[model samples]
Target: MELKSFKFDLDERQVKWIFSPLRDKIQVIELLMKIIKIILVDDKLDSERIKGKVVLRVSKMSRLFFFSEDKFFSINFPFLVFHANKDLSFQSKNGNKVDNKVTSDVLGLLASEVLLSSDHVLEFADPVADIEDYNSGFWSLLKELLLFEDGYIRYDYDDKHVNGQRHPLNHLDIFYCSGSTFKIGLRQRITDNHLMDLLDLETDSHFLERL
Candidate 1:
């Protein structure tokens, strides 16, 4: 589903505040749209699971807002992919023993490229790893787009910390919303730390477009 298809509710007061001093809001949305485009064109999902999907667009412009009754269920996205980069090594959530024979994992592939039709595709588990500063993997680029301060990526997990468990630091923080089907743009409120952090970085590097 496109941005215009969803029914959106706006807070005029918040809308004005969000649009005034903030910049890069469009850049953030554009990045999200790129991710969504990959998802829409990718043929890695099961057909039965991809049906009955809806896209909800919020009217706010702080950080990109993505939510769904089911994880990645909106816009007919297939199962969500959970990944972790630990000890500078790449692996899936299940702690699949990464042998030199296996090079690319789900998270790495999704972040790097999107395949419309291929031999293998990324699959999603359930729940996800705990929230941690995930600034070490492909998710780091995405996390930077989501929050100005710092955050971790989270997708799916079983939470059965038994033997042979894989814990990834970088993950996406998208989850399920079991509630009424309504549209609400969601973005984190900017903070002094966020502004100062960006200012400090501005003196050295231009990670994003000037707003």
Candidate 2:
């Protein structure tokens, strides 16, 4: 049986803030155990199950963020591919055998990429409730008139129109609901990058676009 491994170098600050808080230590060995438990089920492990491993090394430079109220930290980490074995496979939710060797690596890459891309946009708090309070009761009326999430404001768009003209059209444009408020147009052409860029601008843009 061939052995496969995934390895990445995390920032020291991230190791202290994010990984350390997840458990006691922030070393590669500690984080590896946490990651394994998160990605694999208990029954999937065996005594001689192809010797799989995921390793995270600590790099020199790192950035960390602390959310006091949230009681969590964010870290920026880098990855390096060590040994990528091609013989390993995993059973998917559909009972189909698929390649599993790259699963951990892919997840690590995605998390790193998201942190690198969205670090700027996550600095602010949600503005909907704040603005609603200042409007004295206009927002309260709109809350009763519009749909919302379980405890948040959300819009439910329906596509049922006999002539196909009454449907809520989604686009990539920004809609200014008020002087300081805006809504985002969601259409098929708009990409996640575009949305993130608009969000980073600190404008009150809400995504009303559907997939």
Candidate 3:
């Protein structure tokens, strides 16, 4: 007796809906890039250029790390995987080529969770300063900041695990708190537009007048 084999291919529409998480992730990446660009261009921020060609990187588990060159600051996507059934096509894949289209999601959801953490201090390096001195004052401030004794914005998202009045799915953990109980819950998940708006707000407090 001979056995028959078959392979099924997904159409464009199916590919999109099925892998929407990945698509969302790609969009998130794009949004992050835009924010970074805005920061770099703003003369007030005086953002320091990443020392190497790589400003962002993905680990084997799909978590993303940005501004790796700087020890005190970074943006992390610790849980952006969306796996389902038995699909492991993108398993352990660590590259920036997840999609080719401007907003592509060719790779369907490849994990079971999605989270984002935007961690950074208000201070940036002096653009004209030598590379070696990039972390000068910022590092010292970061040390104190690490103890939750300073002010900073840390946007975090988590939908994987939720409990009543505890770990809200969407919340902003402003300033570093020693305990995780301090959280400001939001009614909806944060979007690229929200982040963009935040960037504008941070850049120019006057922007609020326009809104």
For TM-score, the strongest prediction is: 3
Model 3: residues >4 Å from true position, as ranges? Answer: 1-151, 179-181, 202-211
Query: What is the descending lDDT order?
Result: 3, 2, 1
Each candidate: what lDDT? 0.28, 0.30, 0.31
- Minimum summed lDDT over a 10-residue window in model 3 is located at 103-112
C-alpha RMSD of each candidate structure in angstroms: 20.3, 22.0, 21.0
Per-residue lDDT for 142-186 in model 1, tens only? 333334431111222213431231332211232222241222221
The top-ranked prediction according to lDDT is: 3
Best of the two (1, 2) by lDDT? 2
Q: Model 3, range 50-167, lDDT digits (tens) per residue?
A: 2312122223312222221111112342223332453212211222221122112111111112312323221222221222253233233222222321122334566566664487
lDDT tens string, model 2, 1-211?
A: 2222223233333334332323211232234323433333323344344232223222232112222211222222222222224222233222322223333322343245443355564421223344335434333332321222111111213244212333334322122123432333333343323432333323356544354
User: Candidate 2 deviates by what RMSD?
Assistant: 22.0
Best first by TM-score, ranked = 3, 1, 2
Pairing residues by index, what is the TM-score of model 3?
A: 0.27
